[model samples]
Target: MRLSHKLLRDAALFLILISMPVYYLAFTYSLKESSKSRELIVTRQLTSFQNTLKEALWNGDSPYTRQIVSTLGNIEGVSSVVLYDDKMEKIQESNSPSKRIPFSHDMYKELESNQVKQIKTKSEGSFLVSLITKKTDQGLEKLGIIKIDIHYNDLIKSAHARSRTMLAVLLGIFILIFFIQFLYLREFLIKPLSDFEKAISEMNVYADIKLKEDPNHVFEIANLTKTFNHMGEELKNSAGIINQQQMQMINVSKMSALGEMASGVAHEINNPLMITTGFLERIQKAVQNDPEKYSEIAMHTEKALKGTQRVAKIVKGLRSFARNGSKDPMQEVETEKIISETLELCFERFKYGEIQLEITKTVSGKIICRESQISQVLLNLLNNAYDAVTEMPSKNKWVKVEVADSADQNKILIYITDCGPGIPKDIASKILEPFFTTKETGKGTGLGLSISVGIVEEHGGKLYLDHGHDNTRFVLELPRA
Candidate 1:
């Protein structure tokens, strides 16, 4: 799931995998130690038996030999006892129908060599026995081997049971410790980290910085959380500062554009004002003439008034278009009407520059957008296309605007295609970014595409450059109303 949890789980599994072999090794070592202890005990018991037999043999009595055998046989974990001579002949053997003694030449050789020997044999069950002899003080030279056989199966069974019990206890302890640590980690680490992660993920870069505090967490996690919170605060503050700077830049750019358009707006207003003033003077002159001519003069004056009004409207539109602000409210506007109006506004520039415009309206539906804003968007695209085509030396230079309905019939798609050197693949993605323009200084404000993008997004639409085709196509897809 999460990185920390995965790491913790992997660590736990690794510990278990690593501990298994160690546990087995410990069990094997414990069994070996137990076997060695059993061997030592058997050796000591056989040594004592040998001493008893030596004492009996030095007494020079056969009855004492039988007595020694009787006493040795009564020893627990001892199956049978045998007394052997120096000639390798059994001198006295404690005969029991239920018990069998395993005596071999190796046993006698070991006794003569004064070495303790343990031999295991499989009969009714696995058996381990030791053989040895001791010297007598009477010099009778009693070369008697004391034999003690033990059930190897019983010893092994006991060892296995003890090992299993030990392993079970060790495992229980390990589990308990692991769970306790897990609880501690969860309480002091995991919960705090989770809270910190959630806070960081929900943090807004544009909004005020807010840090969540976790006093219950461990020192390391709390410190990390504090560090991340500080980073988020710094980022938020920086973003706000950058946003203010950008707003100021946009305002400055808008002022510059308005300054440049001031002369054109003045000319527009002067022409209308002059016409209106002239029409009023004419009306005054006609009023003094024939009464019939007064009616015609009034109509002509009305026509002049309409012309003046149209010029005033154009100036107002220009002023509004150059203003920089947040997007206007969306409305249902005809795509073809917006395109035509934008072209009409820029018709003078195109005529003066001798740029050809090919406008194609394939769809005649209403698109959800602001009419003035969408007109500005189209104007920007057309203007950019005009500049691009004029810069190229191609004989067939034209800017084409095509409008069509989306395949789903739920949206309208506008494509502005230019027959000029297409934009390079490297810089395509940066084209819509604010202040990113390839135009020469003083020729562009670089806010056209960026503002256009904002307008498109405000209308719940998308504006993108389509470079897959041969021509540079700026596509605008707006939802249908």
Candidate 2:
């Protein structure tokens, strides 16, 4: 449960906690009031008995007075009853033989200001005392008084019975309300909050932020859900801005690398072109001097042709590697040729740096994909391999390129391995992520591997670094057509 929901639940529980006793007390009060009303009715009935006692006294019939007192005593909860004559002398009295109650003289004085008085005794019962008067032509005459004792046990039992019944009823109501509220809150508040927490935890820059729009009746939760969805939308927009900036940065990085390599590429082509021009001039002079020296000129002519072809190959490789802007048309690209040309582009850098290169070709196959894109992937891998090996202190540092058909014959596998300090285990997972690199800041753009991976994946291929090895090795697998 969220803290807010927990607080709400706690508050509800506190209310239930406080309300139970309050309900019980209110019920007790009501029962007590009812008991008092019953007691008042008993008092009234006992007071009415005084009229009978008064009639008997006025007739001077002692037996009738005793009979009246005895009848009043026969009622339930009535322990005893007593009647007094006009002179305050007890003329008639009736008491339960089993449970006797004693009357006090002070009770008579206490009844002076009121028509009825009640006295409670700790051990036996309670006393209901009333005044009896006779009507006369002058006005009213004070005839006598009546006192009745009520058993405490009977009144206590009745009160307890009423209290137990009400408490049971209130308990049922409390439980039903508590369960209904708990289930309601779990569905609307608690479950949604839990799901919201999970959703937030899983949220990322490219994650879809849309959530199920549920009908939650609570205003605060509904508003909070709306705000959360709005925040997700804002975050998504921010992520789009970030991604755009990242793409721009990646483009800049690619251009910077191309600019840096332009000179080396020019040198590679210029050298081959210069050789081809020199060889052609020599062949022309030999042809002009001696038409008879045709065999000697033929060898020079062949060397010149080879030189021109080398220049053409370098230029073609450069063009392929530098191909940019999205629409990469699919074609049958030879994996071996792509790897060789990529190596050719890197040859000038390798020669100047004295980094040894080894090529191992096991099988040749063509794959239907964008040739420039594949060439770009190969160039990136070869350049990264060159850099990796060049950075090492060992003079024997070398990069090996291997192209072979997969065992299943459905795919081509290219392995680029470098005998240099391999990638550290800690940073291996992040190598293909944009802007992640171990190279010195100004020396590396860091988007080489990321871009390479993207291109390979676009062709339904996979590029991955092989871990748990002595040297750094990257594998590229593309489906063969």
TM-score of each: 0.46, 0.52
Give the best candidate by TM-score: 2
For residues 1-481, what per-residue lDDT tens digits would candidate 1 score against the true structure? 9755775797679667866675677666766666667667766655665655566665656798788776766655566666665565667766462656456676455444334566656522323433434445764354545555554445566656776777678777877887788788777777776776777677778655555666866678778878887888889878866985786577567666774586467666777588777867777676867787788877777777776765665565566555543456667777787776677677767667667786766779998776867877888888888888887776667778899888999989999998878888778878887767788887775778987898889888999998787998899999999
lDDT score at residue 192, model 1, on the 0-100 scale: 73
lDDT of 2 by residue, 1-481 (tens): 5565676688668766866686568656765565566567678776676566667777888888778888887877677777776567877777744565666777666666227777766533667777776778987777788777777565566666766677667667866887787788788877888878888998887898666776744787777778888889999989877985787577767665884586468667777687777878777766875767776787768777776877777776775666563486688877777778778877878888888787866578889888767777877888888877887888787888888878988999988898877887789989998778778978776778888888888889999998865789899999997
Best by lDDT: 2
lDDT of 1 at 146: 53
The CA lDDT of each predicted structure is 0.70, 0.76
Whole-model alpha-carbon lDDT for candidate 1: 0.70
Quick one: how many clashes does candidate 1 have? Answer: 0
TM-score (C-alpha, index-matched) for candidate 2: 0.52
